[model samples]
Target chain A: MTARIGVVTFPGSLDDRDTQRAIRLAGAEPVALWHKDKDLHQVDAVVLPGGFSYGDYLRAGAISRFSPVMETVIEQAKAGLPVLGICNGFQILTEAHLLPGGMLGNDHLHFICRDQKLRVENADTAWTVDYASGQEIHIPLKNMDGRYVADEYTLDKLEAEGRVVFRYLDFNPNGSLRDIAGITNEAGNVVGLMPHPEHATEPLIGTGRTDGLPFFTSILKKLVNA
Target chain B: MARVVVDVMLKPEILDPQGQAVQRALPRLGFDGISDVRQGKRFELEVEGPVDEAALARIHDLAESFLANTVIEDFTVKIEEVAEAVK
Candidate 1:
C-alpha cells in the first residue's frame, strides 16, 4: 500500500508544493491539507513546509501555532504521529510547544540563504532512519529568524536524551544552541528542522545532488513497516 | 473595562541578536555610553466590562501561554487601569 503523506499549507506557505512533490517522489501519495482544516484525512504522516506563515507577524510562526489545523496536529504529534516541520514550520512547532526551544533573529541580524551541511546526530527518529549516524548531508537553509534558543536545563535534557537529531557541520549558519539544526521529540516521531530538505530531494534541483532524499524515503519506509 | 499590559523579554541567558546589533551600532553612531541593550515585546489588551481578580488571573495565563514563550523569554503583566465603579 502506498503511504499517504499530508502537506499543510498555511497562508504564506512557500514550499508546500515542493514538500508534496518530494513525498510523491518517495512513492507516497501527497495529500494537500489546509491550515483551517482540522481533519488530516487519515494521512500516514504529515509535513509542515517552510514559509512566512501569518506574515511572521508578532513572531515567526507565532500566530500560526494557534491555527485550527495545528490544534489537531499538536494532539496527533503527541500521540506519536510522524510529523516533519521545516523552517517556518519548525518555528510553529516550537511556538506550539510540540518541540522544545524557540527561534530568534539570526545572530548577525541577516537573512541567511545557503546550502547548509548538517550531521545526522541521531538517525533513530521516524524521519531520519535512512541516514547513518553522524553522516553529513547538504540542504538549503533560508530564513531570517533561525537562531534556536532554549533554557540551559532543556538544552542539557535534549542532549542527554540523544534527541538532537541534526547538527550544523563545517560552519554554524545561525547561532543555534550547540549548532543544532534539527531535533526530535522523546518518541522520535516528531522532528523539526530549520533547513529545506524538500528542496534538495530532487537530483536535478538539490544543488545537483540528492542528499535530502533520505528524509522522505525514511518516513515512507517507516510507514510501510508499521 | 480594564487595560492589561504585558511585557515580554528574552531571558538574560538567551542571546538577543537584534538587540545586540542595535547596541553595537549605537557605539558607531557616537553613543558609546550605553551598554547591555535588549529588545522585547509589549502587548496591550483591553478587556470589556469590569475585570475582577478571576479575569486578572486568566489574563496572566493568556500572557504566559500566548504572549510569551517561556522557553527563552520572560513576561510581566500589569492591569494598568480598572473601570470606574458605575452607579
Candidate 2:
C-alpha cells in the first residue's frame, strides 16, 4: 500500500500544490488538507508548505497557528506523528510551539531568493533519514522574515540534544544564529526548515537538481516501514 | 464603551533592522542627536461594558498569548478613558 502524505493549504498558501506534486513524485499519495478541517484523514505524514498564510497578518505564522486544523496538527504531532514544516510552515511550527524559537525579519531587512547550500547535520529524523549526516545539498531559500532567533539557553539546549538537523554551508542566508537552516523536535518526528525542498525535487526544473527529493522519500520510507 | 491599548515591542537584545533603517535616515533629514530608535506595534481594542479587574486581567492574558510572541517581544496593556461629548 502506498503511503498517504497530507499537505495543508491555509488561506494564501502558495506552495501546497507544489508540495503535493513533490509527494507524488516520491511515490506517496498526496492528500489535500484544508485549514478549517479538523480531520487528518489518517495520512501517514503531514507537510506544512511555504506561503503567507492569513496574509501574514499579526506575524508570519501567528494567526494560522490558532487555526482549527492546527489544533489537530499540534495534538497529533505531539503523539509522534511525522510532520515537516517548510518556510512559512516552519514559521507556523515555531508559532505553534511545536518547535522552539521564533522567526524575525531578515537582518538584512530584505526578501532574499537564492539557491542555498546546506549541510545535513542530523539524518536520523523522520524527515531526514535518507540523507547522510554532513552531506551538502542545495535548495531554494526565499523569505523576508527568515532570521531565526532564540534565547541563549534554548540555543545551547538544542545544540546539546542534536536537535539542530541542518546548517547553512559556505554562506549563511538570512543570518540564522549558528547558521541553523533546520531543526527537529526531541522525538525527531517534527522538523522545520526555511528552505523549499519541494521546489528542488525535480531535476528538470528550478536549479536542475533533485537534491530535495529525499525529504519526501525519507518520510514515505519511514511510514511504510512502520 | 471602553478602549484598551496593548503595546508590543521587541526585546532589547533582539536586532531591529527596520528601526535602524529609520534611524539612519534621520541624520540625513537634519533630525540629529537621536541615539537610538526601536519600532513596535500598538493595538487598541474597543470593549463594551466596564473594564473591571477581571476584564483587565483577561486582556493581559490576550496580550501575552495572542497579541505578542513572548519569545521575542514584550507587551503592556493600558485602559484609556473615553471623554464624554459636550451637551
Candidate 3:
C-alpha cells in the first residue's frame, strides 16, 4: 500500500511544494495539511517544511507554535508518529516543545546560503534509515537564524541517547554545538534539521545529488514494510 | 511592582564562531588587552500586583521557551522588587 504522508503548510511556509514533490518522487502520497485544519487526513507520517512563519515575529517559530494545526501535530508527534521538521520547521518543533533546544540568529549575524556537508550520525531514526551511519551528504542550508543552542546536560543527553542524527562535516556553519546538524526523538520517529533537504531531492537541479531524497525514502520504506 | 532582568547566552559547548571572529578581529584592530568576549543579550520587564512569584515564573517561561535557546544557552532571570506599586 502506498503510504500517505502529510506535509504541513503554515503561513509564510515556502518549501512545502518541494516537500510534496519529494514525497511523490519517493512513491508516497503527499497530503497537504493546512495550519488551520484540525484533521491530518490519516497520513502515515508528517513533514514540516521551512520558512519565515508569521514573519518570524517574536522569534522564528513562537507564533506558529500556537497555531491550531500544531495542536493536533503535538498530539500526533507525542504518540510516536514519524515527524520531520526542516529549518524553520525545526524552529517550530522546538518552539512547540516537540523538540529540545532553540535556534538563534546566525553566529555571523548575517544570512548564510550554501551547500552544507553533514554526516549521518544515527541510522535508526525513521527519517534516516536510508543512509548508513557516518555517511556524509550535502544539502542546501540557507537561513538568517540557524544557530542551534542548548545547555550542556541536554546536549550530553542527546548525544548519549544517539539522538544526534546529523553532524556538520569539516565545518560547522551556524555555530551549533559539537558540530550537530540534526537530531531525533527517543522513539526514532521525530527528527529535525536545519538544512534544506527538500531542495536537494532532484539531481539535475543543483549538485545533481539526491542526498536529501533518502529522508523521504527512509520513511516510505518503513511504511511499506510495516 | 517589581522589575526583572534576564541574561541569556549560548553554552560554551556550542561553538561561538562569530564571537571568536570578533575576538580575532579586535587584536588586529589595535584593541589590545581585550582577551575574551562573548556576545549575549539582556531584557528587562516590570510587573505589578501581588503575584511576584507568578510573574517571575512567567518570565522564566518566556526566557526559556522564546528568549533563550535552552539547547546552547542558559538564562538567568533576576527578579528584583522595585519598591512597591503606587497605591
Off by over 4 Å in 2: B84-87
What local lDDT score does residue A199 receive in model 3, on the 0 to 100 scale? 89
Off by over 4 Å in 1: B29-32, B81-87
* Winner by lDDT: 2
Docking class of 3: acceptable
Error of 2 at A96 (Å): 0.3
lDDT of 2 by residue, B1-87 (tens): 999999999999988999999999999999999989999999999988899999999999999989999999999999998788789
Going through the candidates in order, their DockQ values are 0.74, 0.87, 0.44
Q: After superposition, how far is residue B26 of candidate 1 from its true place, in Å?
A: 2.7
RMSD for all candidates, in order, please.
2.6, 1.1, 3.9
- Ranking of all predicted structures according to TM-score, beginning with the best and ending with the worst: 2, 1, 3
Docking class of 2: high
Candidate 1 lDDT (Cα, whole model)? Answer: 0.91
Real contacts recovered, all predictions: 0.88, 0.81, 0.81
TM-score for all models, in order of appearance: 0.95, 0.98, 0.80
Q: Pairing residues by index, what is the TM-score of model 2?
A: 0.98
Candidate 3, residues A88-159: lDDT per residue as tens digits? 999998888788887878877788888999999999899988999989999998888887777788889999
Candidates sorted by lDDT, descending order?
2, 1, 3
